[model samples]
Target: MSINQSTIKKLYGLSAGRCNICKRVLIEEDVQIGEMAHVIAKNPGGPRGADNLANDNRYENLILLCSIDHTIVDSKPNDYPVSRLHQIKNDHEAYVFNRLSNNRGYFEDLLALNTLFKYIPILELRGMAMELPSRISNRFEAKDMFDNFIRGNPHLYPFKDRQLDRKWCSVISNMEILDCWILGSINGLNLITISDMYNSDPIPQPCYNIYVNDERGYMALNKRYLSPEQIDYVSTEVHRIVQDFIYSHTDLVHYIRNNFNEIEW
Candidate 1:
């Protein structure tokens, strides 16, 4: 049996598209330079091969690597034993999940820090404001407060100086969308019409629409109006971004907390 597409996807995702051995990124400029190296050789007589091992193409038996590392590992099977390879794979996958995944555990440690409480209210208020139509004014207030905090503190802006990982880029992009929506941009026009609020039927609307201007042009950001589903999605996304930001820039978050008394709200 050959390695299937699902297994390949899992392998690449778990490895974060990097070679397990050298931690070098396999995909460069949209070109794939990574190879799937088998822990147990596909053929019985091949390197690290055994008659007992069957169906070696499974994800559990595969490791992602650069062509160079693949050749080296296969050539010197004695040097890289099955046990060592398994350990390496486990460690690499764990590293990717904890450090690169959106739902990482890094932020959990920061929960105990007193400084974390300072920012929680802003995130909560923003979420609550979006869920209720009566709280529309609160939404604008929250946006201003959030923007001011980010603008006033230069240290919190990590995306400004260096190249960021894909995860961080996604977080920042979502934040930009949230900011745009809060500023009252319906579609790309920066103008909201009465028709934007109501559909063809005056009552019992199928969906409430919020538009965002993406590369494909204006598209619905949220389909439901002040819905629990929309609120949950926004809350989850905001929480992820905030948690990751705190984990990534712990010192900066603490800076805000330290000067909280002096900063004008």
Candidate 2:
């Protein structure tokens, strides 16, 4: 039996408008959503079965993901950078085309549209659907979402109800923020350390937080071990990192001081 609309919507809302794995937010103009997948592949029972996935609809068992994610999860035992990821992508592409040719004909209809958009970069093409399309035959056409995602448009995706584990989210977001600060400081695209930020005093929390949101502040507030001076230096380094490039220490410092834009320091 097929999962129903309410079930899909419940997953979409639980995923809260982002791919549960990649955190890519879907929106209009590009990047459509993909299918609602089974955490356990349907072929486990030799054909699709309600009993196989009915108990696994919670957000933990489910993930709202990009089309690439569906191919990724066809990973046996499901993990990344694994050998299976490559094979599944190639195979899924072929399978999708086969399904389309059988069900929707070789011409571009619903299934063919889904198949073509799944593999093609639909962002460059005349899109199949700019917004969510109304269902045909009471079934969501999977390809419509695929077309939108390929084009970089956003869409809502659902997953089973469960909390997202945010530990890595915090880490990655902070890294991006850190990278932004470094890029601004050195402007040279070189590495800067956390300790460097503290050397410069009077570090403004807001300046750094914008890149990663409040994660940096919260992390600093909790780690009270460092001295005020050290933290200040680290904060300044962060600012410096975001402010100028770091090709050579002497050159960058000379450049920044020489060209200090009279912005924050």
Candidate 3:
């Protein structure tokens, strides 16, 4: 069976643009010279033939290789057996995956730092006078709430029904992010002056103008900045939170629907 483009692309990314056998960079000047090699030849009576070809055209059975190494491995299957090739492919993919994860974390940390820079200035510029310390503490609380939400930590909400309370409180906590943004905007802070942390995804028109949102509307705002996989993860989580809120407070949901415009959050 022929390998589809999707499988080939996944193998290309997993190999991290390098040859699995030689561990050499496979692309130069945007031209990909690497080849996809089958760990098990499809020929009849081969050691790793038909029975072992379940994932033959998939990432699991594919290895990236330079032109020379591809010819060498295919010619010397006895030397580079199936087990050895699998080991090499897995090890390389693991290393690349870890490196990418670490880099992503590093990038997120930088974004957090930039957000802090914007946040601190807004608090300071507000000039809360005697309540400055308390206001700053509130800002810290807001940031902590957001941090816990993003990291999937259960927030400490003081109520008998912890699950529902957390779901409700999470919505409130997210509101604070917007509260700070509005405060900054009102105080003549250039919209451009602040990092577009909240605006990473397109802000819903209502969230900007009217400030009304249901769980899905909120999801559109909070999860807009996430990657497709991350969006799926956060979507699942937010859906659960919304479900919990609805199940616990069915009457309130109806009330909100009827009086949402008049109900000042």
Candidate whose TM-score is highest: 1
Give per-residue lDDT, candidate 1, residue 129: 37
Each candidate's lDDT (Cα)? 0.58, 0.39, 0.53
| TM-score for each model | 0.42, 0.26, 0.38
User: 68-165 in candidate 2: lDDT tens per residue?
Assistant: 76666654343533234334433444554566554432222233323433554333221211111110111123234443543653221211111111
Deviation (Å) of 203 in candidate 1: 75
- Write one digit per residue (lDDT tens) for candidate 1, span 1-265: 7789999999999999999989999998999999999899988888899998955789999999999999999999999999989999999999887675433222322322223235435334434433422223323343344456457654443332122323334434444444444444343332222233233333332343454334533233443444676455445544543454444344443444453333322
Give the residue spans of candidate 3 off by over 4 A: 45-55, 108-265
Q: Rank the candidates by lDDT, best first.
A: 1, 3, 2
Model 1: pairs clashing at backbone N, Cα or C within 3 Å: none
**Of 2 and 3, which scores higher on lDDT?**
3
Q: State which candidate has the highest lDDT.
A: 1
Pick out the ten consecutive residues of candidate 1 with the lowest summed lDDT.
105-114
lDDT of 3 by residue, 1-265 (tens): 6889998889988888899877899889988899888778666465455664644566777889999998888777788888989998999889988888866644444344334334343232223212221122233233444455446423222322334335445544444543454344333223211244345544332222112234432211232433465435434543443443334334433433453233222
Q: Is candidate 1 or candidate 3 better by lDDT?
A: 1
